[model samples]
Target: MSMGKKILIIGPSWVGDMVMAQSLFILLKQQDPDNQIDVLAPAWSRPLLARMPQVRQAVDMPVGHGSLMWSARRQIGRALKAEGYDQAILLPNSFKSALIPLFAGIPVRTGWKGEFRYGLVNDIRLLDEARYPLMVQRFDALAYPAGAPLPEKLPVPDLHAEAARVPQLRAQFGLDGTQKILALCPGAEFGPAKRWPERHYAAVAAHKLAQGWQVWLLGSEKDRAVAENIIAALPQAQRQRCHNLAGVTKLEDAIDLLSVCDAVVSNDSGLMHISAALNRPLVVVYGSTSPGFTPPLNEQVAILSIPVDCGPCFQRECPLGHMKCLNDLLPEQVISALEKLVPGHEQAVL
Candidate 1:
């Protein structure tokens, strides 16, 4: 095992991508328990990184996505020079993502061949599409020598949630401990193409509510309206039982609260990956995107997707205007998956 190495991991921009990156982190840790791994990502990701025990520190990426702030990259990169990172692994294949490590003058910089980044990344890899089908597979493969066979089972992301924070968050959100919690992550930051119909989520919420469960909607502030709509669709009695925690809880708060959920039903979004990492009983509804690439890394998940000729187009919004893939999928399918998964999880409820 490579011992006492210091590494810098340039994390991905999206939450799901970042979560999936944990597999590589776990792999690196397994290689050398004493290795110190630090992540460079957006400031918002600090909370998420804190839950990852494998990460030693979270360095906030000052620049936003899309725009390449060379000065900003140079500043952060030069600052990291003193840390003396032995190896810098760039997760995102973008040309800009390679700058910081290069500016830092790290000796061993590695990443997939992207945007013809030659000198920016020294140990560049040539990706054989068939060999590394999943994004997680691609990420984990970087931890080994060029032609090394990956382990039979790559480590899955298991986040560490503070046990004591669960109750406080429950109380903060007015969550009833008596009822089984069903968390609905109805928003997909990628776009509407990946989101399951909000009405469909409401249907699952209603069903679980009928079974004496308290439904909680979780997502960013952008998802507030959808959460409210889901609640509005519920009957008056059930509406009172459901809570729209979306737009209210901070990312860390969401992490702690989600850890205690009896079941989670989410779109193919970051929360889906987070739920899987938390090892929650999850039923993820897929639309434009298929699980073939970035499926939730958990055995406790039930992935629901319907194949349509037009999709998985992987577009931000559907070009055909008809969301038959997700529309046809229906809530009954997700609820049924939940019914099966929840009972098994308790043995370890929806």
Candidate 2:
């Protein structure tokens, strides 16, 4: 609403972070119902933004991740200058991410201090990691005055799926809308350290498949091989019910399809956050990463992790060459978590 402050948000590059950013958007709206929020992020993230009703629009940031394309950012900034944004909240702490708002000459630029973004972000806050242990807390903190205490209950990310298109997508993917479905997100784009073993995933898939639940593997194109491996481990009958939607469905399509899933078991991946936002029952297996930082924010979710001394290493690939954390977090833990999220013993048509 032009009646309130026209705020421009420099959104995060990763899908999970972008989804979590919705909490900040919600807080901004709660603070001022008429606050207009527009996000500048990667083109791929537009689909995620579309589902967050709080966002007025999605502004494409043409620069690729890690690229300091000053000319490109300046061009986009010059174009947005006409919009007259009152404030800019940056989810990313990078110095380059603060450039556009500065270029646009937005009066008040807000973000945490990083890469020595001293003058570029006029309203920067020095982060206190001890105070804000959670990543979501850090994002939410930017909405308030620096050093202000956050609300006791921070809003979780909630994405509105295109429910009307569910049937069409189901038909497109040969999914029966009434069938009991279990969705699995087996890939962690961060790297192998965050991923649970494929065989462990297969073990869980077998548990659900035996209980007459169909399994749908969801991830980006990079995850196709792992999805195939999960499917391969199942018997012919169970394999028929296990569908590899990885690398096939678009991100939005995955969001819509996940809406119909009875439950979801996933690594700490983007799709895991999506499923949580959709309010689907979820069990997230943690490895190199820990839930203490970015736990899935949903009532119907379970956070699973077997803490190894080596982890939460937070590394992309395990430096020790042994991912004891993920490898040891057995399938039974996930299945047990699934049981708590959803009482899944009910009979389903095979």
Candidate 3:
């Protein structure tokens, strides 16, 4: 643990996966404070990676999204060779994900066996899913030496990256600095299957605005239409106070803004993870995905999921046609959940 090892990490391509991967980065720092950790990741995740302080640099893999093989492994191998990395941690399960380090001849490469990559991965570990209490715990175990016990759980993510533009963003957006701000991330990257009803979010925002808090809509370009729908549902007075930041600002800008919020309401998405990482008070709505595996870890966070027969369908879209799991969750219920954190937060303004 004391050795200053040069470690190269092949990062997860998805934003949420990238954020979740921060725990591993944090553990590496805790285990070896001086180790130089660099990440080989897809370009899209670069925005989020910039915020993590643990990573020295995020090497972009110039390849398409699908099962892209040639560029990723080749680029990563050349980079690892040039950087003289001694070990690598592959976060993704694909054989292509492991190809880089193995090709680079890094002495130790670790990952779960997938795509029959036995020889490609030297230190492959069997993920006894039952042994670890949580998904994060299971992922964290991969970073430790073989047979090492799980350490006491910690909440903070290792991404030492910061939101450099938050302060300016606050001024530009005309956000009331002193008043409590509530971030509403209504869209889920996974798909409509995981997203709570738009009405539910609108109601939550309306409830908070009535309580004297300012509502800030958070999401990407794809989520802007949803944000607008929610904004449109609010009363003119409430709408005036609500800000639609979707697609306007960068990813770090949203995180910086999220860090400043008194609380956040989101679906099971990357922003939820960011809110948890920042230790912001949060109410995360879960639908197709169960919270049992990767629920919010921060003390200030809470999960709002209604269990149903088709609870963990785990599909991109609802197979049953009736998205009862999400639609059935009333706005009042989410408002009630938020009220606990921001007291009188619902009744104050109205």
The Cα local distance difference test for each model comes to: 0.91, 0.91, 0.81
Tens digit of per-residue lDDT, candidate 3, span 254-344: 8788887888999999888888877888898888998878777777776887879987899999999999889987877777777786666
lDDT of 1 by residue, 197-263 (tens): 8789899988888878888899999999999999999888778889999899999999999999989
Candidate 3: lDDT of 105? 84
Where in model 3 is the C-alpha error above 4 Å? 158-164, 344-347
lDDT of 2 by residue, 71-101 (tens): 9899999999999999999889898999999
Candidate order, TM-score descending = 2, 1, 3
Query: Which one is best on TM-score?
Result: 2
Clashing pairs in 3: 51-161, 52-159, 52-160, 52-161, 53-159, 53-160, 53-161, 210-349
lDDT of 1: 0.91
Point out the higher-scoring one by lDDT: 1 or 3: 1
TM-score of 3: 0.93
RMSD of each: 2.5, 1.5, 2.1
Q: Clashes in model 2: which pairs? A: none
Off by over 4 Å in 1: 1-3, 344-350
